[model samples]
Target: MASLKGLGYSGGMDIAQLKAFPLFAELPDAALSHIARGATPLAFPRGALICRKGEFIQGFYCVLEGVVKLAFLSPEGHEKIVDLVHGGSSFGEALMFLDRPCPLYAQALTRCQLIHVRKEAILPALDRYSSLARQMLAGLSRRLHQLVLDLESYCMQPAAQRIIGYLLREAETHEGQTREVTFPVSKALIASRLNVTPETLSRTLSCLSEQGLLKVEGKRILIHDVERLRDLGPR
Candidate 1:
């Protein structure tokens, strides 16, 4: 269960906070202010269940700080990480249009703040602002494209390829052949995200360590060979 009494920013979102997100950035001040009036500012502690399957989402949520993951949980306790929403991004846009129960559970991976924009607030905005509608549709299209790519990875890629690809995504900066990637959440969550078991994840990391590819240090991994890792990704 999630507690609504999150620390700080208990009131409705201000127009500035609304504009901070690209989805609403192009909207006029008056439109944004109107939408902000209905928006709810919320915070959640790490490990809190933000929303669950079968819940009727009145609107989408935008991450203002920290990370939230959309996932599926089986009755037998198995878990699959569908996507991770970081700061400055929004989720559940499709839900508003679908008019159906949410299919996945959402949980906070870290202490996070979000703006829950009601469907009522956005529908009128979308009707009035073509830019806002386009942005929202673009966001949804990107998510769908990524989902297709994920399906391809899950179906066609080998386990090592998938793991290496996962590690390489966070390799935004590197010194020579070395780069560092930090796990923002637990290894269990990571394994689920990669569609692998904890034992498999451990074994793969150890193998890479033995091969002088990377060094694992509790939540951080130093990649010693970026090119080699990339070569292994999706190949």
Candidate 2:
């Protein structure tokens, strides 16, 4: 098991970055500074299990850097990749307030840096900072809205469209100005997130390539026509 590190933020991060998140947007500088003071930074090796399902909640975790996979493993031992959380995104927040066991596991897909926030410490911060409460509510609401969108896509869209839609959204949100979009996760992992078979995913990608929509260079996808891919999926 990897050990947690004390909060020793080497080069100071601009508190403004947290402000970009609606959950931390309203937090006053002093309050943000306080929370930042209390937070612990931890390192995770690639493929490390950061948190396991059903484990007692230690605290809420926020990804400070690198990617983390939020997933559920089946009784038969199959794992489903649910969400790939990026930097600035948080997890275990909703569960921190809930009474039930966590239904999912969180794993670091690469060497990652994370911050831990103890639940017991949250109320005082909220009391001292009205903006913190507002930010938390907004963050939670955005997550809920995203879940609804995922549900709607699954129920109302066909498989091809669903896959394409997801890829396009991913493409748009992809960082940098480069034409080639690198898939951070493996194809099998991506297939699991898309709720499709690996073979099916390959076939679909081939089909997309044949239609001149994209060029697959290993894990990187060079999107040839964004509008066409957008049109492939249901609106």
Candidate 3:
């Protein structure tokens, strides 16, 4: 773990950067500026540990650039990737509100720039701005719903189906009949998230390629037949 010795407050982050995030998009400039002023920008190189499991939640974190992986370590020392937080998204808000320790570890999947908004700054703002509180609740609800869906996928879906579902979900973000997707994280991490072995994930990708549904080129995957790929997963 790298020390935060050289980490200094970033002057570049302002109201505009806060507005880029959906949670703060509707906030007035004054409010956004308040939040921005409270933000501490921190950069993490790939594989850097942002927070470890059982650590106290100090503030809410937003990914300004790059990706972060939330994972948990089992008693046997195996790690399970729970979720991936992308740019423009905020995390740790719920835990901060509850004043609880983080249940999982957060690690930088790539070189990342993040803004940490201290709890003291957010709680007062939440009271001063009802819209901010509502937005936070809505975001927490959506995260809960996603967790439910993940539970269903893990319990009811097969490994290959889960992989197919993951691919199809990625494809939906693009606007086309065919889509190109790239894994920002390692395949082993993805396999852990999908609850499958790395070899199983590789085999599933090979099968999809053999069926002419997709083409895998290193970390990039080209989905040749979107409909066929969707058919392999749960509707």
Residue 43's lDDT within candidate 2 is 75
lDDT of 3 by residue, 1-235 (tens): 4423215554656778788988787788888777777788888888888887788858989999999999887789866677789999988998886778999889999988888888887788888888888888899998898777556444534888989988988877766554988887999999999899999899889877866778999999998988656645764
Reference-based TM-score, model 3: 0.64
Instruction: Compose the digit string of candidate 2's lDDT tens values, residues 105-169.
Output: 78889888877777776668877777777777777897788676555434433767767877787
Best by lDDT: 1
Rank candidates by TM-score, best first.
1, 3, 2
lDDT string for model 1 (30-117, tens) is: 9988998778888889988888788988999999999999999767886768899999999999999989999998999999998988
Is 1 or 3 the stronger prediction by TM-score? 1
Can you list the residue pairs that collide in candidate 1? none
Q: Which residue runs of candidate 1 sit more than 4 Å off their true CA positions?
A: 1-8, 157-235
Stronger candidate by lDDT (1 vs 3): 1
Model 1, C-alpha of 158: deviation from truth (Å)? 7.3
Q: What TM-score would every model get versus the actual structure?
A: 0.66, 0.57, 0.64
Model 1, position 26, has a per-residue lDDT of 89
